[model samples]
Each structure stands twice: as structure tokens, then as C-alpha cells.
Target: MSAKQTGTKNRSPMQYSDWPIEQLPGLSQEEQSQLQNCGIKTTVGLVKQGKTLQDKVALAKKLQVNLQYVNKWVALADLARIPSVGTQYCGLLLHSGVASVAQLAQTPTHRLHKQILRLQVATMQRRDLCPAIEQVQQWSQQARIVLSDEC
Candidate 1:
């Protein structure tokens, strides 16, 4: 076990914020387990190489899975690293083609907000999927923080 995994019995869940893969956004519980079963047990495992399209394709080939799934998982890992954008919002962003917090941080909030509104309208069955402007702003701000911290 890693030093981070050590003493898990005594650690409160909130006591650690370093488990990026465990906290990956946009994944159902089952999908998370599946990724681990397929040997992607860490955020670095999925995204260690700058998370390029080529990297995702390589992972898909290595795991013998669909490219789309690998892409989404990489995106989820990246987004989950941000403090404010949790799993639920991660889904919303995924639908908007946001594959990383780096992308989110660079996006203009108004553009993302409008894009989400359009997505909601296109997928009209889920009328309750509204994301507030303030929340998106916070996500973008937090994404910036995460990017800086990684550097």
C-alpha cells in the first residue's frame, strides 16, 4: 500500500483529499470498479501523459475498451481533481464536451453556461439539469486553482 493508503482504518474520509482516482467524477460506482479491474487504478494511470487523444487511445488499446469510455474516464479524473466540481457537475460538463479542468479553467463562463443551456434544451427529458452561473464561475475559478497547484 502507498503511504496515502496506509492507516486507512483510522482516517476519516474528509481527512484525505489526495485520492484523485477514488474521487473521479462522472463515473458510476460500478464504472469506477470496472476501471480499477481493467488496471486503471489511479488518476495518473489514466492521465499521466498529459491526457492527449493519443494517450486515451493507447489506454483503450491497453485495456481493450472503447475509446469513448477511456476519454470520459480521463476527463472525469481531470475534472474530479478540481475542488468544487464534484461528480454530478462533472456529468453536466461531460455532456458539454469538457474533458479536463484545464479546459474548464480556460473556458469563458458565459460560453460554458450558454452551452449547457443548449445541451439541456437538446436533451429535454431532463428538465431539472440546470447549472447556475455562480456554480460554473466557481468551477472555473477552482479549476484555475487546481491547475496552478499541479504546476
Candidate 2:
């Protein structure tokens, strides 16, 4: 069975140009500079360079940072490939347990919405700031479309 059949979907390794790494949320200017210095100026570059655990480990070693840092950045970069998700919502989705476009595509919107709402309320103390159910559904739908396009 394929990864998808086993309930673990994987994104295509195709490298496509996307928003610059600086646009990704939670990355500081210094972090952006460090990545740019290593030829990972764009999200797509980061994703391509850190496609696997070994790749992420190599990147972290090269940057002299922890593996988790590269993992988070790569996850953000991968999620940002979704047109609707973009950089603005990548961090949110990651924190909400939707790390990649594949995960988001398989996630049930109702459950994912609840997770996002709880996270927002716990972190920001603002339930109103959570994306609506329809928006969450749209994200999942778009993620599926993206996965299909990749295949």
C-alpha cells in the first residue's frame, strides 16, 4: 500500500518557487538571514532542501542549529505551498497539528476547526480570531486539490 493508503500522505518532492522565507511567520530576521546565506531564501528552497529527516538533519548541522528548528521551518514551508494557507496560516495550522498539506487534506475540518479554536483561545485568549468552519473546510479542500495536482 502507498503512504496515502496507510493514512500517512506525503507531499510531492517537486520544488516550486514560493514566498520568500522571510514571509513565513515566527521566523526572526536573523533566522531569515541565516537561511538566505545558505541558499534557502525561499520557502520552496527550504522545503526542497529539507525534504526528509536526513535532509533536515544535514541542514541543521550546516546551520549549527537544533534539528527541531529545521523541522519546524520545513513543515511551515511545506504547508505554505497551499494557496489559501500561505504563510499567514501555516504557523497556525502547524500548531493546530496540521503540519503538512497532506495532513491538512486528510484532516476532518470540524475536528481541525475545534483544534484551531482551542489553540487560539489558549494562546491568544481570543476565540473570535479563529478561522471559521467554512474557511477551515476550504483549506482542507484546497489541500486535497494541491495533492491531486502533485500526483
Pull out the clashing pairs in model 2. none
Assess candidate 1 and give its lDDT: 0.67
Top lDDT prediction, candidate number: 2
For model 1, the run of ten residues with the poorest summed lDDT: 1-10
Please give the lDDT score at residue 117 for candidate 2: 99
Residue 94 in model 2: shift from native, Å? 0.8
- CA lDDT of 29 in candidate 2? 89
1-151, model 2: which lDDT tens digit per residue?
0111111224554322278777878888888999999998778789889988999999999989999899999999888877667777888999999888899999999999999999999999999999999989988988887778677
Best by TM-score: 2
| Candidate 1 deviant stretches above 4 angstroms | 1-34, 42-45, 49-55, 125-128
What TM-score does structure 2 among the candidates reach?
A: 0.86
State the displacement of the C-alpha of residue 78, model 1, in Å, after optimal TM-score superposition: 0.9
What TM-score should be assigned to candidate 1?
0.70
